[model samples]
Target: MAHRIAVAGATGQVGREIIKTLAEREFPAADVSALASGRAVGGSISFGERNLSVGAVERHDWASTDLVFLAPGTTGPVTLARKAVAAGCVVIDVTGMSDPDAPVVVPEVNPGALAANPRIVASPVAGAILLSLVLHPLQALGGLVRIVATSLQPVSGAGKDAMDELFSQTRGVFVNDTATPEQFTKPIAFNLIPHVGGFGEGGLTDEEEAIAEDTSRLLGGVAVAATCVRVPVFIGQSLSVHASFDRPIDEAEAREAIRGAPGLTLLDRRDDGGYVTPLETVGEDPVFVSRLRVDPTGPNGIALWCAGDNLRKGGALNAVQIAEELARRGALRG
Candidate 1:
């Protein structure tokens, strides 16, 4: 029997992509309900060949749903996910909110952890998800002691409105039209914003904080430092990661480890432009890594560049994958 799926934040970027990926994967969802906030009610989203109308999630009966995917939104996904779990549905959340009581999972990294959890799975952020895939093989080889990462994130990482704001601002400046910044603190067109989220006391943005915390939790280590920056790109995110390992790792061994990892593809032939750019990685599923080199300063240090579709493997696709896992484990009630 096919499961009944309900998607919260259905009108958002990741939510819409979740619906598309689910359909594209031919997931067995006998009843797929598109749910959003009250403001987005009555709207419609295209799910494959069928357009699903958005309904207010507050009015829906989640108890009858077999699975729920909560997209990133202002509404607390953790709270909603817990409610869905209490209602006996498997909850897969794209938001970075991790409950100490629940499991924060990246399927490729820690799919085993899900079996012990109740019913909710917290998806890591785009940067963390991509980083985990990049680091998985390295971690398996010798284990990572510390990592310094800098993310070049796109405006779409902020949300759909941020993408629109960048487009509108770019056109306004080019056409001499009045430009009003709504989604971002400053103009995003032809410029870079060092800040991606709210700043803390020490000047780290929330996005950066999330990367550090989420990476630690997902990797089962608390030794990663991250600096996140918003770039002019509309989609995809790139990361420059410098990792210190617990033991010596040769270049060939590192390459083989990364190449052999699941959900990751190594393009690290550094002879003649062997790398994956954000544009090349957009809409792609796996985390693409390139420019692998040994850090000369440390005996066990390596630096690499990685990229992936922030909306797909970073958010929506990961959520769908978790749902598939739950279904396979018989966690989803039909």
Candidate 2:
């Protein structure tokens, strides 16, 4: 059965990708509505061959909508999520501001976390999604004992304005025109920012804390220490992960595990240019893993590098996949 779906924040970066992903995957939608804040209500967006007129979220009829993809930057997403759930619509929140009670789901890692007839589900941060997808496959190689990862996130993860900031700042550099920091604390052109989020308890940035918390949650309570850095890249997110396991595991076994895992692509080679990079991963779905090797420093330790389109699997794609899982289970209201 085709469902009536609404994508909130449809004009923003992640939102636009969510809209595009739905159409690209040909979701079973009887009617698809593009919704945004009041200021963006008059604008338009495309869904496959059709151009959708953006509607105000306040004006959208929630009761009639069968499903809602609550994109990041959505207006009053928490309240809207509650309203949609109350209206019997299944909601997948990519905004990270959904109900704290809602389960944070990554379909490739933990589709079973969704309850039968779940009303709302939250997707983890992009770094967490990227980390989880790569690490989940390795869990079979004995239980994951400890994880230490450093995520090099792109500006796009911060939103459209940040992406613009990177572009304008870079162009300014070429023309000898210095730009002020607005979206970020410092210039992002040809520079890296170690501070991705506000400083918080234990002196860890919010982004780092979130990556650690979400990765642990998704991977069944394994200890995770994450350091998130904002890089000068545009589209993809990359991570350097060193994980320790409970038992001995070889590089070949780990490589084979990743190769067979769904939603993951292994691209490891010993040559200089044999690893996956953020540039090549743009617009791609799979989480590309490379530079896999056994860590000699510790028992049963393995290390690797992974990258992927953050806007896709990290946000929109993960939410869509959860919707697909719901559809597969016939848990949707439509």
lDDT of each: 0.85, 0.91
Off by over 4 Å in 2: none
lDDT of 2 by residue, 202-222 (tens): 999988988998889999999
Candidate 2 global TM-score:
0.98
Question: Model 2: which ten-residue window has the lowest total lDDT?
Answer: 114-123
* Candidate 1, 212-298: lDDT as tens digits: 888898888749888887888998899999999889898889998887888998887657777888999878889999989899897
**Per-model TM-score versus the true fold:** 0.95, 0.98
Top candidate on lDDT is 2
Model 1 spans > 4 angstroms off: 74-79, 98-100, 176-180
